[model samples]
Target: MIAYSRSIRGIERTEAYARTHPVNRYAAYPLTAFEQTPIAGTQGNRKKKEEAASQGVYSWLREAGQGQKLLGELLEKLGRHNGVASKEQLENSVHTLVDAMNRWESAYQSREQLLRPEIWEAMTLAMRHPAMELLGIKRGGQEVGRRLVWDPAILPQNPNMEEVNTLRRVLLGSEGLLMDLKRALSYAEQYTPMQLLRQPFIHMYPYVLYYGAAQAYHPLPPRGLIMNKTV
Candidate 1:
């Protein structure tokens, strides 16, 4: 009886160990290839890909799906909120947009782009969905503005009636000023997980069958872009 009990205990231990064992589960969120490396003891900013990937590990533990879904939904809502651009400005609109988008895109792609409180605010306005539908698609192939992450699937977050009404106009104006949506799309296509979410098992049969096993990453959004860093 004692031997029998000991055997049962060993079996339980093995099972428990298996359940608790670490596994390579990317189901939680998308990670760039650079983000796959392990973290260090310090939160050093020099090597960003490492920092983001490490931070990603912690972020997964605290409400993963809801926040990501919320972000997508909010983006979609913003899309619904954006007012149509009238093509009124003619020349000035394109010039103004190109300058601003270029500056922001440059900063975002650079290693120097640090997260400031003000940046969070800018992202709020910049991440609106209409930017994708209008600016991103129209100017996608330019240099790299807001095109990459502009999927129709990403839903918008719920906002007040008044805010929602104003959203479209605001986004259209912003979109008009930019050029280079393609650059952003290229990055997302190369790295982001959001790209993966839009297709295959989730998208439809033929579409999934088309890509087959050639898994790909989602493109990053134009305005609020995130990149992978090496630690």
Candidate 2:
């Protein structure tokens, strides 16, 4: 086409070339989509299924709560807190921290990132949807908006190991994930302070509150994580 267009390629075959060979098609990039597994246990995957049966959730929550508790104190000390973190920062952090740690050898094969693309695919699929959907959280509104609150309370239902694993893969394959997350949360605070105190206030999760404690004190203490009332 360009060859026949004088304006594009300095050629003069315009009418002749077009009539002889009509352009009929275009190409598109492949959709790198994830292949999700069913909730039901399948053959050879029993272990992965039962893994969900364990009290992994309770343990995770306990640990997370402890982390948040600590984070709350830390924030009070730093005087840098405003409110609960918006969904974007939380999402970014998940990718950043896990990816940074994904490089090490794991116990299983599919669990390993060097070979399996499914792990990344699964997460990419989840990310395409709101993070809340796969996690079974009560989701509303759009995360891409200027503000979207991530209520820790809405996240404990579904084991998001698959999602987390995906983040680990991306972050591990490259560097700068963690720092990127930190900077994102920080920038959101600066550019859109409302990002911290916006609508749909999410109740803070324990571990996050503890870890980010230094970042959530005073005017925005862990206790005030859920601003749904006044918010």
Candidate 3:
């Protein structure tokens, strides 16, 4: 299983800290942003699980199709959107949609930031293997020349709490994620991205496409995340 790190100071503890210090705003925007977003119903969660399971078979075409469908729906809705209604009704409807999108975006971004420690830990685990020096996505706090496409150097070095948060923002943003994913998929290997999708770690899921391509060759890649040897 892809072991994700549990929070030492969970949301409740952070809330308590915030409550204790009234004036001290928790500037960790990603950490404390959407504590109240509603989780999806079982059906929705199951659908995600099913989709992921389908992707685990190295079917990039199918996975891309699903993503395209979702994006198409979102765009179709946006294209047809018209807020015309009774003043209060229009306000309420628009507000609801805006709020939903905001919550989703915030929550999605938080996954990476919240799980930064686990990502680092996973990288540490990956580094222990000698092959890491060659197969690793990063090294010496920078992108290795082995995969000379997208620069993982865009990420932080020996990421501290603050730097980790920034790295998450850079990597987890919709555009950034897609860009790196394209680079990873540049090679023509089917199972390259599959292994990444199958990881039990939540944070590592997004990275499957990015690192999967780099480690697509024989001797196979490690199950854990690759690191830059920062630690």
Report every candidate's CA lDDT: 0.37, 0.34, 0.36
Model 1, stretches more than 4 Å misplaced? 1-91, 113-125, 135-231
- Give the Cα error of residue 21 in candidate 1, in Å: 46
Model 2 misplaced stretches (Cα beyond 4 Å): 1-52, 80-231
Minimal lDDT window, size 10, model 3: 222-231
TM-score of each: 0.22, 0.17, 0.19
Which pairs, if any, clash in model 3? Answer: none
Q: lDDT by residue for model 3 over 164-223, one digit each (tens)? A: 344333323343332333332222233343333324465364466456766885342332
Ranked by TM-score, the better of candidates 2 and 3 is: 3
Worst 10 residues of 2 by lDDT: 101-110
Model 1 agreement with the true structure over 130-206: per-residue lDDT tens digits:
54443432335546545333222222334456544453444423342121232232222233442222122332543
lDDT of 2 by residue, 1-231 (tens): 755675564547767666554443544333222212233433446466335423333332343344334434433332223111234444444433333222211211223222233323332333333333333323246653322234444433333666445433333222223223223222212322212221221324544555576576523242323332222
